[model samples]
Target chain A: MVDTQWPVYEVFHQQARGEPHIHVGAVHAPDAEMALVMAKEQYCRRQACVNLWVAPATAILATEYQDGDMFEHATDKSYRESWGYKTPKTIKTSDEETSK
Target chain B: MATMETLQDLDAPLKSAVIDLLYRLADDAIIIGHRGSEWTGFAPILEEDIAFSSMAQDDMGHAHAFYQMLHELGEPDPDTNVFGRKLDQWKCASLVSLSSERDWAMSLVRKYFYDVAESLRLDSLAKGTLIPLAQLARKLSSEKKYHLMHGHMWMPRLGKGTSESHQLMQHAVDTLYPHALGMFESTDADSLLDQAGVCPQENDLQQRWVAEVDKILSEATLKVSVQSSPVYGGRVGEHPDDLATLLENMQLVYNLDPSAKW
Candidate 1:
């Protein structure tokens, strides 16, 4: 059967200035202009929002949750955390005192 | 603001009239929203597809809000109000329940025509003596501005585009123009609404709408021959078959289990 339905677009909403655009929902439209109109009507009725964006679902590249290893973090990176700075702080203090 | 006492003191006739009017308004929004939703994923462009879908959702939302207001007045619950009722039980405007044939030109024309009518109607309601209705109208009116803008923007663009596009839009306008007049049909509660300052005179509203739309169409280089006789039935519950089919689809899940929490 010939496909009759339009393509679906993902909707994102920015609630206020400086806020990140969050994914709200999706709507189907034949073109981008129409999608923006539909997004405004579907997503922004009551909520206060300064901006909206709609993108084609096919355009997004998402990682699959089943392939988990790529997203894992290293547990041995303690030196990158704030606690690692404490050791350097003591060393710097001793060095400054000795130089003085 | 009129004192709450005035709103609370409505007579039986006026209350019935208000209920009748509310049903008409709510049903109009519901049916049109349903029709608009059908365009989902099928608009000519992705942006417009989202735009039309969003507009459709807004119409349904407005319907829900109106139905809630009616419920507070001792009418049926929103579920019963929208789904459980028979076709004849619906009080939407005839213009809304009519199908758009899924034609882009027709959809745009119908939307532009209806938005013009709805915006004016909502403007009148915003000034209603009834506080809650007035507040609701004001909120709806705010959103209507964008809806109207969307329609206004499309009318000229499509009407003046390519020859084929222009012809399609013109034909759509011709097809819908007669039914469009039905948007101004007066309910039996007209006098009651006017007396209570809930709505202005229909003639006044119609005249203003005509003047505004005429200006827009002229700029679009389109001339619409005004129809002498307009078809109207929604106020009294008469509707086309499409409305029945649409209601069947919309209420199928809801009707399956009226008592179940979905």
Candidate 2:
């Protein structure tokens, strides 16, 4: 059978203001405008969403999972993490002890 | 004047008018929702299938809310009112009863036409004197905004798309336009509702509906000939045979076992 469907669009939804638009799913639409409308009806119908965006799946670029070496670190990178900033207490004041 | 808040607040005529109006609204939602749902797994694309299903659910939900309000006014429950009522008692327009015929262009045009009228009607009801109906319309209108947007997006796209698409869209519009106009068929209660400050006159609503539809169609380059006649009788329960068939399908399961909990 001939493929009569439209192109795929990746949907991003923002739950509320100051929130990032996380990728929810994809929908097929003939154009960007229709894609956005379909995205709302498909993904945002039951959920609370303040904003939505859709980009053609063909427009997106990504690295293959097989190329994990680009994302992997060869050496220890724990110093770059926030958890590394925590240090054992050298001393404790009476005020700190009371607060704790 | 204070708004009518409940069925008991109205006199005999106003109560009757409100019931008539509620039936018109509820039947329109239920029937149109049913027709839209026939496209559930059959739409040209999966996304459209999902979109139509969502809107169908919204339409049915709105219909149920209206039915619930009627139940408070001493009518039977939603299922009974929807399934047990005789065909002659249904108040849905012929516009909603017509089958989509599995034509994508016809389906989109029908939705665009219906959504424009429904959006305008809901906006007017949102400010009307029936407080409960007004509150419900207010809530429902927000959800209908997306439905209107869906219509707005597609009507023009297919209208201006390829030669074949354009031809199909124009043909669908020409075929469905008269039935679409029938959505404004007046009930005997229309005047009573207007006099009681409960709702706008159907004629006035139709006028606004015409202007809005024309504006959108014009932008799509689709010409609407000035219709010489507006199809009527739906508001008073006269409908094409299509409604009978649609009701059979809609009430099939419920009628099979009215007492069984599902």
lDDT of 1 by residue, B52-116 (tens): 78888889999999899888888899988787888889887666777778788888888888889
**Taking the tens digit of each residue's C-alpha lDDT, what string does model 2 give over B1-262?**
5788766888888888888889989999998898889988888777788899889888999999999999988889998999899888989888888888888898888887888888888888888888888899999998789999998898888889888988999888888888888988877898989877778998899899889988888878887766646677787779888898888887899888888887
Off by over 4 Å in 2: A85-88, A94-100
Off by over 4 Å in 1: A1-48, A51-100, B1-7
Error of 1 at B66 (Å): 0.5
| TM-score for chain B of all predictions | 0.94, 0.96
How far off is residue B47 in model 1, in Å? 1.6
Q: What shift in Å separates residue B110 of candidate 2 from its native position after superposition?
A: 1.5
What interface RMSD does every candidate have?
Answer: 5.9, 2.5
Q: What's the distance in Å from true for residue B41, model 2?
A: 0.4
| Position B255, candidate 2: lDDT | 87
